[model samples]
Target: MPLWWHLMKSVPSLQIVLHRIAWSAVIVGAFLFWRDGRGWLKRALSKPNTWWMLALSGVLIGFNWGLYIWAVNAGHVVESSLGYFINPLLNVLLGVVFLRERLGRVQWMSVAIATLGVAWLTFRFGQLPWIALALAASFALYGLIRKLAAVDSIDGLGVEGAYLFLPVVAMLVWSETHGQGGFFDGYGVAMSVMLVVSGALTALPLVGFAYAVRRVPLSIIGLLQYVAPTMQFLIGVFVFHEAFDRDRAVGFAFIWIALAIFAIDGALRARRANARAPLVPAASPR
Candidate 1:
């Protein structure tokens, strides 16, 4: 999606965001209808709190998307990568604070270490890592809202997309009037098609994430979340060739060490849990 956004440099960032959301809404909305039909939609829409929660989450995710796109397009891919890297830790903090969940001692230590890593990065940069911080905070809050709401993944997304649809449409209309719309202008069929397909690119992974979070513990989800940022970081360093001096490496090293500790702790607990489970004897035939 970032690559596509970069290619569409002629288009306004807001316009790109709107186009992606509009298409994603159509794709996700269709999937919801196919899976549950009108019944589930009606049930989901009936609750007022659902709407309120979805509305707030919608704004958060929308901002996250826009900022991330801008970051990638503005040659800040490394910073964008850093944002996702911080997101899982932020989720842990949110879980403890808002969800009233208790972290293990090791987990707390890991958080402290990660905090130090972020602090190091901030000191080195001489400015707040606002992009990383914003992405982490927004996504963590979005997940918390969805978890508390206890809505089905597809249903929640459909509602969230609905909330965004109107404003996106208005933006598109404004772009068209201003003669800056990329969709109909001479941007070529390939570009237009790519822009349209951005919807699926945006929505599918989110559907999977939303579904998984409902079924899994947030901690487990957090551990798994590192895969995305790690890949992004590799892409930024190797592919985009972003600066990675010794000072930045030291900061990242701390984060990686923190992750290693967190992963080992989780493995130990899982193993202990498995060992403690009592095996059941087979029932004798009557």
Candidate 2:
């Protein structure tokens, strides 16, 4: 229940995600350039194995983003919001299934509670939370593959972008030539900004995430990584005007309770270890 302190406040969700992706692309791509420049470019271009794995991860991430943006924009904010709430649990599941990570009793209980919350939400809503599940599963599998491949985050992303960008470029050019395309024109400054910066923004948190993964234990980062999704959820409820029905309220309450238990368990475990880490607060604005 770490207090979701307002952080990184920005534009609308669509713009935020879009701009973040763009910024990450430029920043990370430049980092790759400085780190190895032409040699890195050559290596990335020449390495089919690298691109092969990266291609799959890229597609998964792209699909996740597209679905997520569409969900938010198409008045499915609740579903998109649910996806983020489910993400941490999905990550834990991935760790358990793929990395053979062990779960503590409390952790297992947390997962169980979370699962029940999802099921209850689904039953009450009378439909599977497909968007949430898709977002969670896609992102979880993407992380698993990235870790398993052990590829350089930025460079690997550049390769992924190259793979995606080529076909996109062709389509863009073709449409424009045939007078059917509006990219880079319809949105004026917005399109210009996105065209140049989308890749960099998409790439930054990843670089931070990569650096964080190496510097901190997986367990620690996993806990910290909750910040982003929690932020996304708030945006959904407050900024996006998503209604909270009784079922949503109940489901979210259960999820919050599970988070509380998980947080307490983590705190207790940390205390037993005599760790000096600052305790995360338990209050998040509703």
Candidate 3:
């Protein structure tokens, strides 16, 4: 993702997002066609609720992608990392408010700690961490809608791409006509190729994630998600050499502690659940 951000440095962030959507739509749409043909799509489109939910999710994800790309290219990768770090906590809050889900005492404590961390960052920065908050909220909402939509992951993504396709095409055409387009604008062969490949870059990981979620335990998946933001944090601090002062460190430390608490709680729950399940006996005749 960082590499893609770097490669797309010269292109407008919106354009990068548009191309990603356009390319991803083609790839995911193809995969959906191959996997389930038109049947899955027909069923999905037959429901008005599905269309509404997907349209909302599509917009949220588009905002997320555009903002994230802009943040990375604008040298705010650390802030972007913070956004993802806050995402799970935001999900918890959203569930409470929108889904009427109750939080256990430990979960409440974790949320409180995370809230403090966000507050501290806001205080030190003299402004709300809008980038972080926006990213977290948008993605949490997207996830909620997808959950409610209850469609196959690949098929849902195809629907999202379909919603985004026309706007992107219009944007690209406008850019080209106005002589502001990056593609074929003398950026050379490698970049043009990268621009085209961005579609695969965007879609393949999502397909992999969708596949893994079905097989992996939710606890493990939840814990593993931190890996991406952690890498982004490292890249921002060490590779990109973004500014990191003591105050920000203290704030991030609070969030880390909260995450640790959340993760341990989830692990314990998973272990208990596993222990309570009935064991199957081996077949002697085999």
- The best candidate by lDDT is 3
Q: In candidate 1, what residue range of length 10 has the lowest lDDT sum? A: 1-10
Q: Against the correct fold, how does model 2 do in TM-score? A: 0.76
Alpha-carbon runs more than 4 Å astray in model 3: 281-286
Clashes of each: 0, 15, 0
In candidate 1, what are the lDDT values of residues 181-277, reduced to their tens digit?
A: 8678656788778778888899999888877877897557757877778777777788778788898888888888888897888878887887999
Query: Model 3: how far is 27 from its true place, Å?
Result: 0.8
lDDT of 1: 0.82
**Cα error, candidate 3, residue 98 (Å):** 1.8
Tens digits of lDDT, candidate 3, 156-197: 999999998998899889998897786876556787788779
In model 2, how large is the Cα lDDT of residue 98? 81
